[model samples]
Target: MSLWKNRNFLLLLGGQGVSEFGSSITYVAMPLVALTVLDASSFEVGVLTAMSSLAFLLISLPAGVVVDRSARKKLMLWSNVGRAALVGVVPLLAALDALEMVHLYVVAFFVGVLTVLFEIAYQSFVPSVVTKDQLVDANGKLSTTQSLSVVLGPPLGGGLVALMGATRVMAVDALSYLVSVVSLLLLPMREEPPAKTAGFSWDAVRRETAEGLSFVFGHPVLRKVVACTATSNFFGAMYFALEMVFFVKELNAGPLLIGLAISAGGAGGVLGGLTARRVSTRVGSARMIWVSVLGLGWTGVLVPLAGPGWGFALIAVGLFGFSLSAVLYNTAQVSYRQAVCPPELLGRVNASVRWVVWGTLPVGALVAGWLATSLGVRETLLVAGAGGWLAGLWVYFSPIRGMRDVPTTEPVTA
Candidate 1:
């Protein structure tokens, strides 16, 4: 039977799809808000983005332990509620003309913390809802929708911004979390109760944190995954911090065109999503990693080379290649992790992996802003593209490059 026929999976997809779209909306609208309404400088905008990403660095370890200990459903539920309230406050403040950079900072940081909880829980929660063998298909489906969200969200947000303004678009983001909460509430399956033996303590946090970290670094496949993902995210952040600025200033793109550029780049993501499993199965998983990250990842450099009008076509062309390969790479890696990692350690492992990979984003974001201030946008993008191209070499040299399939979990290393 197809996994799509499963009711709970569908709910998970629908709810997350809605929320993803909402967040993507913010991706476009947030910078526009900073640039247009608040008159934030490029550096200030980077700071705001950095503040949000700071949570992965600040709390990812503890958050992982917490997700492992708690009911993932409840954690996700409360996390969404918190996010809803935090983000919803923005529009209210905007209406009252009371919104400020400080408010954005506070919201970004706290919401980021909740996001850590939600994402760890979400990644850990998936295996409970499906058989172990179905993981790739499940991840592929989710990734496909995720790519679709990227394809649709920006343009939708851009159109709304054109009509309703960015604050209103943020309000829509808050509403999307509510939709995710509803989906969580309706899930037919429940997260396995956290192992009774694992109790809470500062000692437990430190020990378990080490265990999670050890698993990621100790495992050959996971180690490479971390290296490549971290490098991509770091450089991606440097590029992303300046991307909106690039579109507006360098290409002289309006909001719609900016959305188009991002969407076009991701056009291949949908294709990648649909084919990742098939391609990886046909070739080898390790080869797919190199192909996706190394082969397609470098195309992102084309964004800097683009000009306005017909010349802007380069962004879409580059994005199509980059996005396709990235989605393929991610779906394979995530499925491999979910399939191989021990259940007791899933939350911690996911969090540990995220800690290393996502933690770079803030640093990258801040650096991009600073670089844009001193070096300029195109140069920053050039560096970002080249960095992305080289990000996967660690994988190429590691055992991950030679593996035919994900390996079984190894004994926990001290």
Candidate 2:
């Protein structure tokens, strides 16, 4: 069946799209609110950005346990509701002239916690909505909108910020969550059977978390893919942390050009989503995983080559290539993971991958900051560009290197 005809999938896609669009708006507005209203310094803004990813490292293992045990749809609904309330507080505090940087910090941290819960459940829940064969198409459709939201959300956010205030713009973000909640409520219940446990206990949580980590590392293909993703994310985070600073200070790019360059990444993501299934089918899914990175990922090297005048296009092209390869790699690998993991362990397995991969982001951002101070922004980008391309060698050297298509069924257990 065509995903366009799948009503439940459509609801899930729409809800997530609305939610993603809102988050992208906050991505722009949150830092601006801190910088303009709370008078935050550049260091403080960096800390604020780091706060959002901190929960992934801290609670992702426990979150996997929660997703495996609970109703994923229910968890998603509450996660959205919680995010809405947390984001809504910003504008309310601003109106009362009581908003502080500390308030933003707390909100950002707690919101990150909810996001961890939502994402794990979201990935685990997809299988229940579609058949095993539809996983790629479903994920690709979801990715398309996610990329589209990133493309459109920021410009709308900047405009809304100009017309209404950064704090007020957050109100719109909060409202987007409500839209997600409504869409989620409209969907029918998921078809997957609930996972049974020996009941909840601290010991059980510890054991379950360990099981998740073990499952990911024990699988031959999963281990290598996770390593590649982690390495790529680590350096990718570094590249992004310095990208804007490099453009403004080194390339002398104004706001208009800067926005255009950032938008190029979103455009590339859109293309990747639209093309992933076709590309994977042509290139073979297993082969495409390594091919996407080794083939297209090296374009990040173009970024450090950017300069004044016509040279600014290098930044745009580089970001476009990086985003394109990332979305392609992610779509293929996520589908493979979903197909190969045991049903009961899906939540835990997905969380384990995210924990390791996303855990590196904040660390990489901090490293980028130090590198920029030590080696200079342009030179730091050179390190990031080369490092990102090399990261793909993890899968290249592993068992997946020779395979054409990946297995769609869980590995047989003893």
Among all candidates shown, the one with the greatest TM-score: 1
Poorest 10 consecutive residues by lDDT, candidate 1:
405-414
lDDT of candidates 1 onward, in order: 0.85, 0.85
203-259 in candidate 2: lDDT tens per residue?
999999888899999988899999999999888878766665676557766444555
Looking at model 2, which ten-residue stretch has the lowest summed lDDT? 405-414
Clashes of each: 1, 0
What is candidate 1's lDDT per residue for 283-321, written digit by digit as tens? Answer: 765467776787778788887898878989888888888
- Residue 373 shift from truth in candidate 1, angstroms: 1.5
Q: What residue pairs are clashing in model 1? A: 265-319
